[model samples]
Target chain A: MRVDVRALGACNRLAERGAERAADALADLTGTDLAVEVTGASVASGEDLAEAFAGRESIGVSVGLDGGLDGEAVLAFDSQQADALLSLLPGGASMGRSAVTEVGNIALGGFLDGWANYLGQAIDMTPPRYFEADGAAVLPDGALAGDGVFLFESRLDATTTDLDFSIYMLPDSGPFRDLVVGKTATAATPGAEGAAEGTGDAGSTVVPYESLSTFASLAKRGSTNAADNIGMMTGLDTTVEVSRLRFVPLADVPAEVGVEPHAGTVFELQGEPSGYLAILFEEESAAAVAASMLPTEPDDPLGDMAENALCELGNVMTSGFIDGWANVLGTSIAHSPPEFVHDIGSATISPIVAELGRRQDYGFVIDAAIQTEGVQAQCDVYALPDERELAAALSRLSET
Target chain B: MSHPSSAGGRDASGSARRVAVGVGDLAVVDGDAALTTSGLGSCVAVALVDPTTGARGLLHAMLPSADDSQSSRPSARPAKYVDSGVDALIDELGAAGASPNRLEARLVGGAEMLDLTAAVGPRNVERAERALADAGIPIVARDVGDGVGRTVRYRPNGELAVRAADGFERTL
Candidate 1:
């Protein structure tokens, strides 16, 4: 369900007021000059929540809501930013848990209190739960069990300490949408015009899911190319079993693929319509693939030769993925030299997810799962388009 | 091997009931039953059992404490936070005919899992330990720390079996 522009604007104002109060509370508590800015707001899904925190490691403090509202209010800060905030407290470095807990209690509590006061409703908030992990780990299971979430994301700048922090409010979309739309439905017709005017200059537009099929088809073409290349390189009969372009919650990517450590190649997209491309193989599958690459050294421990083979494999595979996208969208996209990382799938992809999440609510993932005959080996190829570029590409397609 | 009234037939043995405690959840089971909590990454699951009575309770707490401004607000889910969750589990176990004096606690989970800099596992373990100590409940055994998620199963015989993601099973 699409959130009307009027509802988004109202929530934005509500969130801005909340952020101001939270900033004041933080300043009073820490004895520092703090400025809070409501950077942007959106109606996001559970997947969006996951995507927002994708590969970045942070401290997340979530307080659940009860009574009139049902959802969560989350305040997240990067580890460095958290330390910066903590260092400002009395003996903050040593005080750790209690200090962080108190900060979350005040800041997020104030934000929720603002919403409650504005709605003229009594909302009971649960005590904050502290999680120190990537976004997916911090979010509880079933967070996306509902339709979506209303996100009011803000930036808190501690002027005295030069620290910047992020705060997010994820209210249950059903209740939040009802509350905002109910209040503005009568005046929203005219406000819609105003919203169009406001958004016109920003040039930010939501690309519908149907249009993303264009990217999906391009991804399939790339995967087919990758399969053919794999067959030629390893003499293994490879088939692309699953290929699709879909919007997934950033946090859910690692979980989608098992969280186990996987040997993979990471490549950055450069030039026009840039993003990231990852070629990951499950541990056993990677070992098998690496072994298959060099028949002479079958017992190798995926050393330099195996890594180089994987990188070459990645280079060929990514060319297949990106070239198709560029051909379809009529944009030139260049990929950097492949960098190999053998780490947990989540840790490996978190940074890319975090970057994309920061720009947009939903992360568009072009995924192709390939299976090789006679070997229990499978490879996953991911093509992540930069949010803005994908939007622009889709806008161009619409225009054409 | 099946009772006519046995719905779903998941309980073919018909002797033991399996109680699943989800994240931010708590449960007390007595008689022939088992308490289980799965996919515990950075959360701690505290299992309290009376060996003599076979009365048990499990709590899967996410956060360290509940000393926030909203702690005074009624209707808060006690199992969601460590401090209150431990207390609530003890109270529930007591109500389930488990004596507080004879109650022995076993802690499982609280693993870092991911390679993030912020280590919540140790902190969660510490908070649960502290809460148990404050409540005067002696911790008999624990399988905590390490960077791996765990699935804990507490049987009626007071055997707490902890399994890692790699299929390694250890009984505490």
Candidate 2:
């Protein structure tokens, strides 16, 4: 099944609209002005999702949907904000979890209206389930560990108060897959027609949504290869810690990489889906890793010999990284000679972002973190592919 | 005095309230608060200050022009491009009780941190300069166009500090 390139974007709009209505409903219930800060749909592993909420304590309510769409929705606020919201209710501090649950039920009603309206059907929702615990525990037990799921997340902030809320929608795999792959069917569903009309761009390429997951797995394989190459060259035990795909605005790339000084190598990929790849290491980690590859300890860890050693390592890792995609595409992918760079983390990234920004607004960043066991060495790998080309390549995958 | 406003956070160097401008974002502040942004490479951060009213605005722009990028989204951020970002900063500072005639621009960032074929740092700097000149704002101070990333802190009192990754710090 082929999916329109605009399918994901249309889904993002639906998520944003739902969040906006939910914010309004919450405002009316609590008389506190609220604004939808940001909303998007991302594909990530349950482990990564759980890791995102590891530290914060949150309170909110969750509900399951049965009709029109099959999935679960969660509305939560930080513990401090929950306390402030509790004081706003009629029962004040006495209402506690029930008050939050009631608000969740109402706000969720507003959230589902967008999806139901678009689907041209009625959706049934289960009773609200109140939760007060660590943010990770709030998700359903099945969503805490293994497979990747398509998640819609929206954040809302109160304009006049220091409170914020996050809404997470986890649609069951079947419905979510059908939503994106709808266009390929001879008979288009109401939801698919709406998505096509919402984008107003029909000439673009379409690929099966399932191919996205396939590509994500390809990223996981690339990281594993890089880890093996690191272990071989440095004689250090290396493991792939985090591997995930992030879809974000090209403009946000620099800030997301952050402000720390880094030492690394950059390469430009040349193939079906031409793109860029960067292997960045913390300053100290770069020094240590570079030294490990050399027979003798160099006077300056980052000197010419160390730089050359690092470059060779990056060369082999780059080949190992893109080899998977090449095999999947049935075409060879070549990369430029590694360019050694030492600068602030974001600085090394923004140049590539600007280059990609010339033709694309959003990027699918395949990122992975590799760490040396019992050592301070950590390497961050980022691969950004041209969206149009990627869609074309993935469409070929569905054909095969 | 610690006002503890929701819009501000603890400054990295002191107790003063600070608003951080992210990539392709902008902020305007009143009174004695600080506006800061970090890890600027090819992106340019422009600060427009009106010393008379102590009102200031900062813009962190990633590209030279909006035409250079393909953004199909409806809410294309104005601060993502140098020309539009400068215009937005000027309008915001004006709304914050700062007179347009008295605005002075201080520029930081725009570094070619990597030797890529299509260098954008110089183009971003050039565009920012032209944008400010067209807005009739004087270029009072600037730290631009090098091979290093920089962090910037701008105060309403016309103090701008630039810190590079190589331990170089200067006040403009």
Highest lDDT among the candidates is held by which one? Answer: 2
Inter-residue clash pairs, candidate 1: A47-A249, A50-A251, A51-A250, A51-A251, A55-A350, A55-A351
> Which numbered prediction scores highest in DockQ against the true structure?
2
Tens digits of lDDT, candidate 1, B1-172: 0000111112225666666565557888777677776666667889898888888888876656665312222223467567888998888778778889898889987766433224556767899999888888899999998766677878877889887766799999
lDDT of 1 by residue, A261-337 (tens): 67778788875577777788877778777766675775466778888878887887787777777777878888888
List the DockQ of the predictions in order: 0.01, 0.32
Q: Candidate 2: give the TM-score of chain A.
A: 0.70
- Could you give the interface RMSD of each candidate, to one decimal? 15.0, 5.5
**TM-score of chain B taken alone, candidate 2:** 0.90
Interface RMSD of 1: 15.0
Give per-residue CA lDDT, model 2, range A346-382, as digits (tens).
8888888878877665665555555665655667777
Instruction: List chain B TM-scores, each candidate.
Output: 0.87, 0.90
> Cα-based RMSD of the predictions, in order?
20.9, 6.6
